[model samples]
Target: MVRPWIGLVVLSLGVVAAEPPKPVRVPLKAPHESTIPEGPVGEAIRLGQKVFTNTPLHAPKYSGNALSCSSCHLDAGKAPHAAPMVGLWASFPTYLPRAGRVGTMEDRINGCFLRSMNGKPLPTGSEEMRCLLAYVWWLSKDVPVGAEVVGRGNPPLQAPAPADPERGKAVYARACAACHGEDGLGSADVPPLWGPRSFNLGAGMARTSKAAAFVKANMSGLGGSDPLSAQDAYDVSAYFTHQPRPDFPDKVKDWPKGGKPADSRY
Candidate 1:
């Protein structure tokens, strides 16, 4: 009987020993850190500088043209009628009447290649594109995002006729040169009207067709006093289009191989 009692006690002890303990719950907290690395911002800016002036990215056919992003964007910051790329990233995914849709920064960059650069469109989600976006974001940090950018910091559009280049040159020299400089290398508030910083002949300055139509409806900045005539627009555009373009590499060896050539519209 004692032995049976001993066996029962042993069995009870075994059962107690075999039972699992209750699990304790602990709350988890996220670490205090940034998702992106600290140095990447600077790196992105550097990479953007590289991509801006690289013509090789256009490749094959457009290789003859020495144009780069800087060719139009200029110093990667201040440009007028061309849009200030500095604060651009914050406002993207914004609406564009031309496209009849909202577009992101990437969309705008690709559009530049197509419309302004006269090159093929870059692939979406590409590293080069992302770097460019990052640079723009970094530049635009202080500027408010999503604000409507009308007339590109200029006054309302004028219905007057365009000015002649011969006449406009005098106008540019007398009225505009104080701020824009003789060569249209504009000061801080004013932007360059020509040089690598100016708009492309095919896109912003294209006088023949669609681009001209856009300019006629939306051209701005006549000092809020005398509006430019249609002829004024044509002649000034001629002068700007004739301005020199910057030299950049003809081919991008680093671009991924087997990439398709951009569509003809670019």
Candidate 2:
């Protein structure tokens, strides 16, 4: 049996363990909008912003789903935990273990096109691609090369359950149905969870773990506040990700050299 003082010391240790040390962010500055000079370059930058926000409207031919780039990136990729695109201009040409090779920044965007947007890859060197790249470049104009942004992607959290679809269905009814609809089809104010218009199986959201991480960060207010517990997030994510949605033809090509995670639908 432990003494009361020993128990208190253990509790104090647990509390200290809970708080993760903050990561040191690279010192870099993002260009201001007012800095955009009036000229063809400015016009292109503005167009790029539109492309990020109104993807389907601008690049209808390439879009296969209803989501715009802003859907996941959030606020045209400016929001922190939603994976801001601000410092990515200099971070690319890096190796992605998923691809098993060093790929250009355009490759990353095209990966989203194929998976998240459930769309065809934009033609190389197309006007649409140029505009999208320009917008990202402008966002990183003031950022120095080889620097990192503090909040570039969905923040991590405690490990969630392996996911039980049935439990998730009930959780969704209580917590998510209000915003995402009983059928999992989101309304005009929100993005759909699963449907013909939703992201394909190749999207990161399709993975149970990835969806759980995203839910941990933003389950309310369009990725603003999370009201559900970690287990609930995993359950709901598993249920929705397993539901019928578009399928990616190139799923067979992914993780070609092995090392696929357990939750991969393919």
Question: Which lDDT value does model 1 have at 67?
Answer: 52
| Model 1 segments more than 4 A misplaced | 1-38, 54-64, 79-82, 146-202, 207-233, 238-266
TM-score of each candidate structure, all chains considered together:
0.48, 0.85
Worst 10 residues of 2 by lDDT: 217-226
Cα lDDT of model 2 by residue, 1-266, tens digit = 99999999999888844676554476434577898779988888889899899888898988888889998887788877777888889888988767778899889999999999999899878888998998999998877676668777887765544678899899788778888889877877678889998999999989988898787676743333347888888888889999999999988888866788888888
- Candidate 1, residue 84: Cα displacement in angstroms equals 1.1
lDDT of each: 0.51, 0.83
Give the range of the ten consecutive residues with the poorest summed lDDT in model 1.
24-33
lDDT of 2: 0.83
lDDT of 2 at 122: 92
What is residue 158's positional error in candidate 1, in angstroms? 3.2
Listing every candidate in turn, what is its Cα RMSD in Å to the true structure after a full C-alpha superposition? 18.8, 10.1
